[model samples]
Target: MADIDLQIACEAPALPDAAFVERCCSAALDKIGRDGALAVRICEPDEIRQLNRDFRNKDKSTNVLSFPFELPEHIPDELKLELSELGDIVICAAVVADEARAQQKNLNAHWAHMLVHGCLHLCGYDHIDDNEAEQMEALEVQILADLNFANPYETL
Candidate 1:
């Protein structure tokens, strides 16, 4: 099994403890069969909104934003073994809480879903198309199920 180095920075009171976030991230990485280093930042609405607007051109707060690392193609083989930095996940505590409440879903489950979603993004999974969305969602559902959580897409 590969090792995952996860760093969690919480800027909101609603965010869970570092240990819980680390577990969620580790589970995601394990499901994807990857070992990497990543950072999860739990921030407030304003922080998320600014990031969304700047990076995605959306002037609103989102539940999460993923910044995947792209390595150069010409890197030496030996260098690749020492490089494990995957990317960063920025999650908005308030937005996640609100969405979970509005969707009538469990808070912890929803948070796990977000973490899994972000980690998948780091692994180059995207939902820009229907087919891609289906594939990604299936992986997410399977991962969540393995973690004893319900399918995130299923209505409550």
Candidate 2:
């Protein structure tokens, strides 16, 4: 594991809890365990939509996106390089708020969920398949539980 440089910037309508942001980032880095650097940016919907189209060729804003450092898969562990410089996470605050309301959850908890999900992506985790989804969601539940949030997947 190499040193991880984590940078989190929030550019949205309202500022979030500074301590919560730090905790979330720290938890991510802890999970990443110094494999690489990470930059997490919380943005507005329009800004995220533009990024979604520009990078992913998608026209709508999504909750999160992860871009890993350009690297080869066969690299040795010590020589593996810092892929975690992992890239950025663009979250739409309005979308998060709306989702929270729709799901009948605390806004902060939803924010934490998205942040954790994005961080997991930064650390090379994904949910593109069923098995992967289970693993990733399990980890998310454990992490969020540590933060005193309820199991995110529980049915209301």
Give the Cα lDDT of each candidate: 0.84, 0.72
Measured by C-alpha RMSD in angstroms, how accurate is candidate 2? 3.5
Error of 1 at 52 (Å): 0.8
Badly placed stretches (over 4 Å) of model 2 are 1-14, 32-36, 71-84
Residue-wise C-alpha lDDT for candidate 2, range 90-144, written one tens digit per residue: 6778788888888899888888888778878877789999999999999888888
Clashes of each: 0, 0
Q: In terms of lDDT, which candidate is strongest?
A: 1
- At residue 95, candidate 2 shows an lDDT of 84
Residue-level lDDT of model 1, residues 1-156, one tens digit each, is 323444444454556666677777788788888878887888778888999999999999999999998789999989988899898898888889999999999899999999889989998999999999999999999988988999989875
TM-score per candidate, in order?
0.89, 0.78
Q: Which stretches of candidate 1 lie over 4 Å from their true place?
A: 1-11, 72-77
- Which lDDT value does model 1 have at 87? 85
